[model samples]
Target: MANSTTLSTGKTFAWGGGKSPFSVSYGKLMMWIFLLSDAFTFSSLLIAYGFIRYSYQAPIANTIIKPLQHVGENFVEEMKKAGLFVQDHWPAPELVFNHFPFIHGMHLPLFFVSLMTFILIFSSVTMVLAVEAGHRMKKDEVANYMLLTIIGGAAFLGCQAWEWATFIHEGARLDYNPFGPRSFAALFFIVTGFHGFHVFSGVVLNVIIYLNVLAGTYEDRGHYEMVEKVGLYWHFVDLVWVFVFTFFYLI
Candidate 1:
């Protein structure tokens, strides 16, 4: 198996810093710093969400991205009280999210969003596997997993595009709209959409890495730690979604 690390050449090797002066690489360090900045951007958005909710006196989780299915016995009752649906007081997320354009009939909740999250998380797994394969010098296996990761990324983007379409058409406005049903609509879109943009950008980055893998550029260079770095970025995007899912949809 190939070594996990690519050593520095000449003088820098002699210096013998424990981590080899950023064992990851200058580009990777820059990527991490950029990711930190992106983290702050999300912080500002989530904080703004808190401020707006405080202003709206909104029902909190009473509505928005309802659960895809019932959990316990009374989950339906609790969901109904959230204001998203009207009926035998069954629940809303299922109807609101699942039904989509078919409000007259019952369906499921946040189906598309759930699917997107699944794709992203799956991509993270594939990316980690790719890095593992790289460590073993299984170039073909690494490329396969990396390709799958790229496909997962594409699937995620497709889901996000569809989500934006649904949101924009939902009749809510910056002034007032249907799903904003309160301030929640605009805030949900802004927050989720911002994250989706990051996902799209991440997909682009993945494509670049995938191409490099296929071209054998990284192999000849004698190191694949960049895959590990990119994997970090991919996982961060997925982690942010977890918070978004809980706060925006499930609460």
Candidate 2:
């Protein structure tokens, strides 16, 4: 016999445990579990980065130039002369990531990366709007928002590729770094590459879901839970980027 409990109004409820106690679907629950594990992985990577970065001496201050100041092609050599880009000290992120598309020889510290961050955060917003449209069973709205989200993600990827190209052109490599320590370039590549891969995967998934929405698949299924699930993944990716930005750029 199953156990039962009486409510205050004298209604009886059985403790037969076939259903989820948390009232969540098995698929959603599994997605949560996977996200939890992924969170642990990202946490481990960031923690490792933090440990290694703190082990090095603090970054040297830049007192010579201000933003928008014209710099010569020998900027890296100059920074080296100023002791700002030495193996013994961490490179200041502003000096390392100052270039922008179509802009040359100007000290625009952190400007491009800030734009990338904005693009990603805006995509996350579109994702939320998409999920909300899904809740209302508005297929067209969901598709539109999803498309915007995909475009935003693609733009971010393109920016990242450009940034990587610029860094490589300036002589950043796994084994060699003109910046500070070799580990700096290596870790930057590893962490940002990993995050970029996730963004790419999320974009692919969004495309598939968008197509399914156009085909009325979720409409036939009478729910938009798939969109919600993918939204969870997308939001997680965005949140991880926040931490990565803080650690890599702001710190």
* Model 2, C-alpha of 81: deviation from truth (Å): 1.3
lDDT per residue for candidate 2 within 128-188, as digits (tens), equals 9999999899999999999999999999999999999999999999889999888999999
- What lDDT score goes with residue 146 in model 1? 87
Report how far residue 244 has shifted in candidate 2, in Å. Answer: 0.2
Q: How do the residues 1-251 of candidate 1 rate in per-residue lDDT, one tens digit apiece?
A: 13234356423342354453555577788888988998898888888876665554334345344344334433334444555433212222334344333332333567666777788888899999999998987778888998899899888877767666765564445555443245556776788888888788888888888889889988998888778888888888998888787766664
Q: What total of clashing residue pairs does each candidate reach?
A: 7, 0
Question: Candidate 2: where are CA atoms >4 Å away?
Answer: 1-16
The CA lDDT at 44 in model 1 is 89
State the displacement of the C-alpha of residue 147, model 2, in Å, after optimal TM-score superposition.
0.2
The stretch of ten residues in a row with the least summed lDDT in candidate 2 is: 12-21
- Single out the weakest 10-residue window by summed lDDT for candidate 1: 85-94
Candidate no. 1 TM-score: 0.73
Query: How well does model 2 score by local distance difference test?
Result: 0.92
